[model samples]
Target: MTFPKRFSNLPEYAFPRLRRLLDCHGPGGAPLRMSIGEPQHAFPPWVAGIIAEHAQEFGKYPPNDGTPELLSAISDWIARRYRVIVEPDSRISVLNGTREGLFNAALALCPEEKAGHRPVVLTPNPFYQVYSVAALAVAADPVYVPATAETGFLPDYGALAPDLLDRVAIAYLCSPSNPQGAVADKGYWADLLRLAEKHDFQVFADECYSEVYRDDPPAGALEVADEIGADPERVLVFHSLSKRSNLPGLRSGFCAGGPQSMSRIRQLRAYAGAPMPLPLQRVAEKVWADEAHVEENRRLYRRKYEIADEILGDVPGYRPPEAGFFLWLPVEDGEAAALETWRMTGVRVLPGAYLSREVAGENPGKGYIRVAMVAPEQELRHGLTRLRGCLFG
Candidate 1:
């Protein structure tokens, strides 16, 4: 049998591996899932109405890049949220979800080779899996960097050897980072933009969790890019309505960057991209243009943050997330904590290690569990209580 060698060495997908680790034993009590970050709040009421109104457009093929209305809505959101103006026609492309855009952007922009070396794709050790896969798909060397409490859960690319940086092609950064809710600020973005300029690489900023936070909103990449006066091509930003509007199933998101970079992306996507259906695009236009639902969603997450602090505040090493809807609770070992929590309280949470790859003599997430505060308030409180009791009690 012949198989592509590139994918042969890939690790098992996270969930199946999780199943193998925990499914043998029955959950100790009624299940309380805090594993995935899927939002459980109510989507805006207008979604259905907009969908029904535009349902007739489904008879025609969706525009590959996105309809003008959809792109304009995204542009408006960007302008309002980040104070950066991107021409919807050239700088933005709608995505089925940020994940697809993130993965595809790597393929579209990563050079075939860099400095006569296999280009390196820099990724956080505990990263969204797609980043690594995208690097592999493009035959680039994926270099996992540590993003842990020791570094404020943000990868410090500057620390990489100079030789490595010279060959680096792209870097993936997540603010209000997944599985760990650390938000990168203006200074962090500034330093990164400077590094990108010096190294001549692009940054793929995953800001999907931008809307769920505690205090002031996390500073965005485009906002920082503008401050630095860097070439627009230097950075790409991906944002989604899934977390903000509680509409994950809608699969609507946008990626925006310099016109040249986006043009390449759209060119590739024209043949390969799966456009959001016209009906869905119409609904998304409304979703992006309206901030009421997003505000309401943030209020719900704020409540969860308060609940988490009250329950876990006293525990040593308990650092409440500044942004995003996750509790990256420090544990003795992520696997042990996850199994013990499951066995004793039936609170299903993912081991932080599962979201990470062992890199450069470390697995950054090995000593923590990432709990999503996405359940309803009552269920969320119950799950948090269970987690605290089992892990810290």
Candidate 2:
């Protein structure tokens, strides 16, 4: 049997790699999970009632793009949150999750070649793995740019050489990024959009953690693109209920872009995409419309932010997360720190290297560990304390 060589060089996924590295060691104290960014907060209690009310819809095929109601709700939320008007029918495609849109949009948008060469897909180092997989699936070269402290933890695509930039077909960016929790501001999005226009590439904005923010909401790609008056099809923004509403299992999200881009995305989805279940879409309609539950959810995450600051404030190189739930902490070596912390404190955390790839013999995430602050207040405090003492002490 033969397999495609496109994925031959891919590394083992983050979680299974962590298990292989740590499972042999006996933990020194009570185990606490601070590894995966699975939210532990309460989803709205009303969710159950909504699902039950729409249960019979399970017998029917769901709308490929989205139900008109669900799309309207999502567009209305965008208007309220981003202060931008979008026509739901032509601009948005409902997703099972942002991961789906992030992967599939590449398939639907990337050209066979750019500048008469195999197109390049740009991803930030220590990025969500799906982005790289999507590039490989299309036989494009996956170029990893470093998103380190020097670059504000977001990949600096503008810095690439002109020759390299011209070969680019798509660039994946995550604001309020996974693992690092760095939020890309208005300037960031504007600069990226401008670059896309000049370079003739599309920007795939993965803003799943937009709602898990603190203080002012992070500037969105949509509003920025509108302000700068760039091509609408140049940017596709992916958002999710998973991080926003603590509904990861709900698998509800949406991708919004210009008409042509969306047309292609939806067309591909019609043939290959699994339409989200009607029951879940019905529940998502309410979830997208309701901000009360979202407000309460943000309040909980704010407390977690405060707890993290109190516990890890003095640790050198510890930048408080601007948004999202993970703490990207610098250490001497990520895997070693994770092993020592688990053996000494029983706190499970992910080594940052697992989320990054090596280019030119260096993995930028090798010296950091990503800790997910998803547990309740007290438990989070316990885990942070142990992590501080075990790793920093």
Which candidate comes out best when scored by lDDT?
Answer: 2
Estimate, for each residue in 1-393, the C-alpha lDDT of model 1 and write its tens digit: 887888877888778877888889899899888888899999988789888998899898999899998899999899999999999999999999999999999989999998789999999889999999999999999999888878998999999998999999999999979878899999999999999899999999999999998989999999999988999999999999899999999999999999999999999998888888999999988889998888899999999999999999999999999988888888889999899999999999888888889866678788988898999999998889888888887
For candidate 2, what's the RMSD? Answer: 0.8
Tens digits of per-residue lDDT, candidate 2, 66-184, equal 99999999999999999999999999999999898999999999999999999999999999999999999999999999999999999999999999999999999999898799999
- Candidate 1 deviant stretches above 4 angstroms: none
Pairs with steric clashes in candidate 2: none
Candidate 1 structure, TM-score to reference: 0.98
**In candidate 1, residue 314 scores what lDDT?**
100
What TM-score, computed on C-alpha atoms, does each candidate reach? 0.98, 0.99
Candidate number of the best TM-score = 2
Task: For model 2, state the Cα shift of residue 126 in Å.
Answer: 1.3
